[model samples]
Target chain A: MNDPIKDFVEQHREDFDHLEAPQFNLAGFKASLAQEPMVKKHRILNIKPASWMAAAAVLLVCTIGLWFFNSTQQTKKTEQHLALNKQNKHPKIAEKPLVKAVTQNAKQTQFAAHETTSHVKKHQSKEEVPFIPSPDQMLYTKLNDSASSSTRLAAVLAIKKSELISYDMLDRLAATIQHDGNSNVRLAALSVLEKYRQDAHVTNLLVNALNHQNDPMLQLSLVNLLGKMQNVKIDERLYALVNDPSTLEAVKDEVYQILLKENKF
Target chain B: MKLQLILLFALFTTGLSASAQKQYKLAKNNGKLNLNISGVTVEGYDGNEIIFSLPKNEDEEVDERAKGLKAFNSSGFKDNSGLGFDVTVRGDDINVNPVSVANQPKLSIKLPRNVRVSFANNSNMYQDTVTLKNLKTEIDVAVTGNDIVLTNNVGPMNIKTLHGSVDASFPADLKGPISIISVNGHVDIALPASVKANLEVISNYGKIYAADDLKIAINPASNPKTNATGQPVKTLTIGKGVQALTIKSLAANSENQDENAPVFGYEGGNYAESLNGKINGGGVDFILKSNHNNIYIREKK
Candidate 1:
């Protein structure tokens, strides 16, 4: 069987050797390669390495500048706060941050600012430079900031001596009468406000203060103040005081006396 | 040699005993002491340091088992002074606070005569009376339900008490801007008859009494016309050319009116009355206010 296969291959060897291979076609192969999809080549930006380093440096500088500017603004604000506190003769309040101090007294500050702006506008016909806080304004800040009762009392006394007491000052004094922790300070403020008792706003403030005050002395003083005015508006408040169980008997007696004088009892 | 050794031992023991007293050196001038503790006696002496000591309690037996261990409390303070007080000094201010509320030992504090003292009793449970003696400087005290007694003090004092009495006696030359206020308690103040000061005594739901020795010239309540300046102007001329005292009785309707009047008029009422006057010649302000109690102005003997 191996001899037969060898004879066949020997007979076919001449034919296989005579058979030629197909012709090669370079242009056709190239055309077929062109028909296939082209792959994208990654190209870098046409920027220099030094330029990139410069851009990074500029970014770093901008970041540092922004930080420095913010810090400087904060420092300036702190210095301004310190200067204002010093003007009030309270050196201790300078220790706290300006944001904390303002936010803590946001309501009082807003009232004072509004009052001061209106007061300034009323006094000045022409537009002036940025408003500088008056000495009274500085003292108003101290009235709320000073922790010592004696200092607050002194501040009130100083305001009492002011030649021209503005409505804003009266408003602040009224607020002190309502909220000051020390009764002595509240009493002093009440005495000062009594000078302007004829003003409707001052009377309204006194009536409102009567509701918040629990001290017997303050309550009696308020009752007497309102009774002297003979304003029928405070009768309801006085009646409420008489009906409330927490009202001191002394205050109720004063209210009754006032009502009796008015013939409303 | 034996005798020498015995002498050395005696000397060493003496030194140890002397060093056992707890003391803190304070500034010689303008020093301040702040004590936020109760159940203590504060006495002023001629010393440059704040010396404190705890009284021995015979009833409390020693615990032998806890001898080696350090004591700690929930307040996170150790017994550093062995006097149940943690005293910290910042600049010229000395702050003393109790380490623990439980088992508070009786403390005696000796302060310099010239140093200012501020005492506060914050504990509601321990409302023991505090006595301050021989203080020659500013005294500021605020307490709750604790009676205060000040003796031999020449003060610019501001004292406030709630549900407690105030008894203060000043020297002949009393330096004052003295204000004493009490709520639901009596206020008794004794000043020398010759002292020069403007005094205001206010009592709500109580009465005001003054001694006969005090030459108090009562001024009539000012009318609206008299107070034209819108300020309270009180003028008095007792015997000579001296300012007058204004006695305001808001409780004229009360039922208890004393018929036998001593030196000043006594009208009884639950309402508040304010008496403003000057003694000798007006110099400093001395105000005494009491709510729900009587006010006694006595001439110091």
Candidate 2:
């Protein structure tokens, strides 16, 4: 069955050999192989730009949403704090603005000083300057707002150690002596006020404190303090105390002794 | 059968009434207890609740007329605790006030050991003494005419009374910053021998008595110089070049010992107008001040 096809091929063999086979071209094949990737690269480049923009838009939206949520939470926390402070009716909370003003002034002073200094000095001083609550604020808050009597007593003692006694601080001390429920705190306040006994305002405060004071110890202290003053005009008040039935016998005796010593009896 | 039922009903009613009057207890987790009512004896216990009850008297009987009726008076406080007081709890603070000021009862309060206590009675009509016992916390007491008796307490106590005496007995290990001021009454404090304290006793017009066992070191006056008139002079050194001279009278001295020594009556103890000394090398501040009454500091036996 194959004899006919074989005979035909055998007959065409000389013709096929006489025709030259097509020459092999390596450079063209290499160029075509190189051009295949360029088309794939262009296709990839054309597809990526829109996806990148969409991803960037999502990131920007997420960041804004997070910032907005954080700011709202902060505002809510501040509102809660203010409301709680109002309910507590604590004077220290109410005086936060005063404290802030004092800190702000201190910061301004530091800023002014920094302006006059070199960068190195500024950095050194910034590290050195710590925010300390002013003595006035500390005394005011502790004396007025502290629930512990010992803390108030400590505040009075601290005021006693301070070299400078402001007029406002004196008034606060006087108020403490007059109105503080704890006798020890009142006594401590009295001791602090004794330093300013020579001042007319303090003398008046002391003289007036005797009438409102029912504690025999406080009355005695007031009498003794006022009696020691050089020109205090408390003789009439002393007589009044002697006449007042509410005044204790011990206080009356002290007043009498003071009057006798002064030759005003 | 009817008789048996009647007997059972009577028994149940009696039990109910008995249980009703037993005690008023409020569960508490250690904080402060503010007692504005007088005539209360506060004792610390290990239980985690506050118990308020009237002191039992064998001869006392409940008023039949007061049954099913709350105690009412002009004080305007309702007896919510069923112990003749209005007990309110705010946060961790428990406040106790008498329902009727006119009918101030002798209440016994058993508190948890960790709770601090503050008692204040400013009314002159309520002169019943207040007692605190077996407490190991800070105590603040202010009363007008009622005596304060403290026993077996370790404290950072501040007790002030206008005309009331303060008698305090401390445990062996005394914690302090203890200040007791009685305007016209005596202050008697007994501390164990092992206690270490800085004791400052001031009796302006009275005497200070101390037991012999306490080893007290009296501090010297800042300036001991006396002027020509025999008045004590205090010379304060001011700034760089200033010396402020302050003349204080002998009468101002809390310890006018020289003048009062002849009248001292204690047999084996020391007596002075004022005494500022350290007991057992001085650990905590203990101040006792009285204007017109004596202060007695003794060692606990």
Candidate 3:
């Protein structure tokens, strides 16, 4: 248990215990769309700007190139953080203890961490199950890369980890979701929000998008969240939707049922 | 000569005077009561005191009873005179009619203020309404072959009969838990909004419904512990801050809440063993079993 890998796993377990994930919106985004006006558009591929298929094809092609692009970039931030804290040497600030422990002794520590995790998953699964970065992270890393920019590479790696605690990672993820993401990636973001849906600070933002969004697919994702809640009192936004004549009949009915089941109606 | 005959008749009358019927009374605390009965009709009375009378029978197995012999005249009758209630044998079954208050049985003992009661009738038919009231300090009951009516506002109570239907009424502010089970019969129970308890109900071949403004919370996956220990050992504790209530029909995964939320320390026993179909709810720990019956579970807040 004294081992750093085990210690980190324990800490991870505690962090996610009794956690309620904050929900996020599921829709297309536009980064800096409201920021700058002047821009020079590049004409590389012959396709309409609104043709999502063409953009997806381009992303599929870019995937191969970005894989190698992001890995080399990840160590740079760790190196930067390491250099800044070199004198203090805050071991706790390491981005991924499992990863760091593995790198220190890759094969041995990974085996030990896995052994402890298989047994400790009762509570620890709350954190580990959700944060186990998806293949999308790897794909995101592969597609979005410039061999020279280490910051962009760091973002790519952080996407793979899905444990991005810094604004740097959030901004990059937000930027990627906004500008160049494929439809599948956009949908994946919505699905991933279940792990973070209960975070109070971000839940309202997610709820606002769900309430206002016209996309059928995004609405479906929002509807699914009704099943997960138990302890928290029903949100008032949903209360209005149940009776609001302006809302769609089906959505209104769904909201009403949730309210009725909770006896808030 | 006439004077001599009169004097002999007077002497015989005084010498052979029959004994008056005897009555013996007994009182019991909260526990089981096994009564032996013969030609006894437990008449349902509305008042607090249970009254008894020896029936006048024209024909019966005991010739003494057939000749209108009072129960107190019998040798075994306990004379509980002027007490709360009395148990007496009656020759005619007409006194145990349904129109009157012939529902709840009059038992000897008094229960706690808030307690759960269950009735299991093996033979004969009886019917009456059992009420659980606001001042539910004691539960008095009777049973026969058929139906049992729970007209009293009892505590977290259970009423199960092997062959009769259970029809009971609960108080608007029912502060205690309740469970009524009956075999080969239908059960009908209603609760008000103010009643809060985890309702694990079962109506083996019958329908169940709670359509009023009642609030029953159901959380099956809320705390599903899948192996792995070292945490607070997630237990499906119910009945905390709730008036105790539990009912089951088969050996299903269940939890019985205690009636009183008293302090408890782990005695050195197999904790996991006790966790078998165990859930903590209400304020009491109930040991429930379901054997061949349709089961239902719900929570009303």
Candidate 4:
């Protein structure tokens, strides 16, 4: 209440209060405001955070679509490649045209079976000797060279499937079982010979394998083979191994078990 | 101490130049000998003690002669428990320690029949062969880049090799398990005709040949499991035959996953061809495995 401004205001109160009021023209002021450069109406649609989000969503959808399309194409390509590889690996067996030809030939042969029966028999006798194609024969020849073990195995399997394996082939399999550096190739040879167990030559090879093979795994197999023959001579040999003090206990136990089962005790 | 150090240093620097032939008669009484000789073949001969033959490098110009046994003792060979030769009253455990020596010389070791031998020979660029006859205990042998020829050994044999073939003959009296593994080579084992044991043989990128005369109980109709290469699994019994083996092949039903399907962005490829069977009604388990090679089991008549 005692402020200096208050005293000054009291002194000039009448002069300040007696000031005249001027009439204002509302319409003219509005006209002048309008004449002044108004904020030029924003002509361009301003980009917003929402607009950016929508653009990103569109880009994401396109990327996903492209990736899905590429993956599907890649899968198709891989499948085709694998099918081609299978065909290449087994050209003789996998050639679809050859299979179809075989079927067609069989169908055609049914019409004149009696007319060609004797001729067919004569051809069949000769066919049995070298029934496989020349390429397979070449493959069998490669089996003897110091080729890769895998290559040798492939050849053996192919030969087994191509024909009634000749005695010569069985001999080769026996030699492989005895001395092949690759056990897998040897095993494959053994499997191929499995169908020829009744052959005297194969039985002799089995007996030879039993006598000379040194690998325990191979020996086990030979023993198993010899046992199936149920030969009295083989049983006696097995019993002798069981009794031999110099023999391995694990091996002796095996022999003991076999002898017990065969009632050879 | 300084003088001793100097003498040792001088001895090490001039080590290869010394062409000395030495023999160690360790444990005149029945004891063990642990020995490791690289770039040399150790032909094990039966004896009552350890005899080491260190041949003299007579060639004067060849300064890279192998030094005689690094640490020797009349009682036994000195070794760290883990890697070196451990010769104790109990037995011998010999391990391969990569010791670089100039022109490494061969060492012939003769030991008593009572000794248990653990021999590992890993020589680079040399094909060393090991022949052990008349062994009485378990044998653990590993040879790399070389071949193993074992004969008339009685014990549990665990043999492994890389880039080499394994040929082992087990006596009929041999007991315990025999596990043989080879990479890039063949495994040939000869067993007595009456041997009975559980068998698991696997060969990747190769074939399995079992003797044709052996009756393997394989039913392809019942066995649905084909190998990675689609070879049907042949499961059968040799001796008394054990419980039926469950052979796994390719999938037989809808739930069975495609083996060739891409897994984790990689192609699912199975290359192993395996045979699971038993011999003599299937007793103890014996495993023979080879990668990129063949496997053969022969009967020891």
Ranking by TM-score: 2, 1, 4, 3
Cα distance off (Å), candidate 2, residue B229: 22
lDDT of 4 by residue, B1-301 (tens): 9999999999987775443544555654332333354433344456655655455545545324534435434544454221233334433333333233333445556656665565555555755666666676655566666677778776565666667788877676765556677766798877776666656676654556665334433322222223224444333322111112222221221133443311110011134455655555655445677766778777676
Model 3: per-residue Cα lDDT over A1-265, one tens digit each: 3699888888799676878877653432344553334342334344566787788888987996796677556655444322111112334434453454345344445556667777888877454422244343444564475321222323343343353232233334444433422222323344333333444423443565555555323343354353334444336767655656655444555566567766777
Can you tell me which runs of candidate 3 are displaced by over 4 Å?
A1-265, B1-50, B53-120, B124-135, B138-145, B172-177, B223-301
Off by over 4 Å in 4: A1-265, B1-23, B28-35, B39-46, B54-100, B213-270
Residues A1-265 of candidate 1: C-alpha lDDT, one tens digit per residue: 5799889989899877987899999999999787654422223444568999999999999999999998687556444332111111234433444544454355446656767777698777765444455566679877886445556665776776443355567788888988886666677688677755655566788888887787665787687667766443887788889999977666788799888977989
Kindly report, for each predicted structure in the order presented, the TM-score of its chain A compared with the true chain A.
0.50, 0.50, 0.34, 0.44
What's the lDDT for all of these models? 0.68, 0.73, 0.37, 0.55
TM-score of each prediction: 0.56, 0.63, 0.27, 0.36
- The sequence of per-residue lDDT tens digits that candidate 2 reaches over residues B120-178 is 99888877889999998888998889999999988878898888899989987766568
Among these predictions, the greatest DockQ belongs to: 2
Displacement of residue B75 (Cα, Å) in model 1 is 4.3
Model 4: per-residue lDDT, tens digit, A173-195?
Answer: 78888997654456566766654
> Model 1, A37: alpha-carbon shift in Å?
50
User: Clash totals for all models, in order?
Assistant: 3, 0, 72, 53
DockQ of candidate 4, scored on C-alphas against the true complex (2 decimals): 0.01
DockQ of 2: 0.09
